[model samples]
Target: MAFFQLWNSDHGHVLEACKDSLKKLQLDYLDLYLVHFPVATKHTGVGTTSSAVDDEGVLEIDTTISLEATWHDMEDLVSKGLARSIGISNYDIFLTRDCLAYSKIKPAVNQIETHPYFQRESLVKFCKKHGVSVTAHTPLGGSAANTEWFGSVSCLDDDVLKGLAAKYKKTPAQIALRWGIQRDTVVIPKSSKVERLKENFEVSDFELTKEDMELIKGMDRKYRTNQPANFWGVDLYA
Candidate 1:
């Protein structure tokens, strides 16, 4: 289990957060710990984390904190036996490259938004080349989330995905997840209902053909439903 920080972590806050997590989970150690996002925010205090924004409602980010420094602190968590492995989330190719070049303890994984709609082939290949595992978040293409946040389309209802699903005797979602697995990333799909959970989990039994895989891959419109830049009022990707 990975303990994600409520606030952007500094050296002191990193240890503090880990201890707090252990106490909450009643676990002495964790198999994996992760920095949830590449960005960090202002530290309110221990036991409380708030996203402090300015008068304009733009987030007041902690410009003082650095990724490499925070990662070093995370590496110490392993030394202290708080976590066995550490990884990062929402990092791009350049940021990942920097971490690979600078760190003594390399990131074990890079969790990012990946689906049939937004393949991000270069970044995925870059991480894989450097021995970093890729974990796909929002793997099924969050239709509800997309409608809520960006008012954009979702891959859940995509024609190609649906067609493949029908051909394979599976759900549209199953086709999306199978496509993700075939792309060589770990897909973390979510569901509120028990049936959906079972549906999402039982994807390994079926396999999409090479032609089907390419068909799904070709559906990439570079359409990003989750846009942190628009949400945060900062273009993190740019």
Candidate 2:
């Protein structure tokens, strides 16, 4: 499991807390350590029910702690052997570019909400150009926990998705995951169910054809299922 840092008054303290937690967990090293959001907010620990919100009830952006500073700390973690690699989560192209400019140790990966419904091709291309691996969270279009976002808009229920699924003899979720992997992005679909876990990993066996891929690509709704409203004041994409 990955550990996300909490938003605190002091970013340094947050990094230290993460290191301490790693020691308590007895993890020799973390495969990847990520900045949970672009801005710091209240943290209720891993798997907590609290949402990322601000004083105005808008989703907050975390650009206050400069990307350069965060990247530097991440580099330190890698150099000190606490983490094998460092990366960012929920960063857009502009923020990513800033990190690239300032980072001595380029990010190993960028984890984001990517799926058939929101195939972030441009951001994916930018990451690749800079030699950063892209990891997709919500590869199956998110989880049941964020049902308002993922469940309300059912990509699986689309006729086109269903048709392709039938033609390929695969589930819509599998097809979605396959699309991501085929594009050379690592997909991490969240599911506690044993069967779903097994199903998500089974995407490697089949390949979606050009026609099938085109059809899926055409399904892009540009849906951003996870943007925090508090980011309105921050120029996250700038």
Alpha carbon lDDT of each predicted model: 0.81, 0.73
Residue pairs clashing, model 1:
none
Off by over 4 Å in 1: 1-6, 9-12, 47-49
**Candidate number with greatest TM-score:** 1
Runs in model 2 lying further than 4 Å from the true structure:
1-10, 42-64, 149-151, 230-238
Query: For residues 1-238, could you state the per-residue lDDT of candidate 1 as single tens digits?
Result: 5445424533348888877877887889877787877877777675565555677767668778888878888899989998888888888899899988888899998989999899999999999999999998889777686678778788888778878877889989888989899989999887788998888898989888898888988998887778866656766676
RMSD of 2: 3.6
How much is the lDDT of residue 102 in candidate 1? 84
What's the residue-level lDDT of 105 in candidate 2? 84
Evaluate model 2: give its lDDT: 0.73
Clashes of each: 0, 5
Each prediction's TM-score against the native?
Answer: 0.93, 0.84
Q: How accurate is candidate 1 locally (lDDT)?
A: 0.81
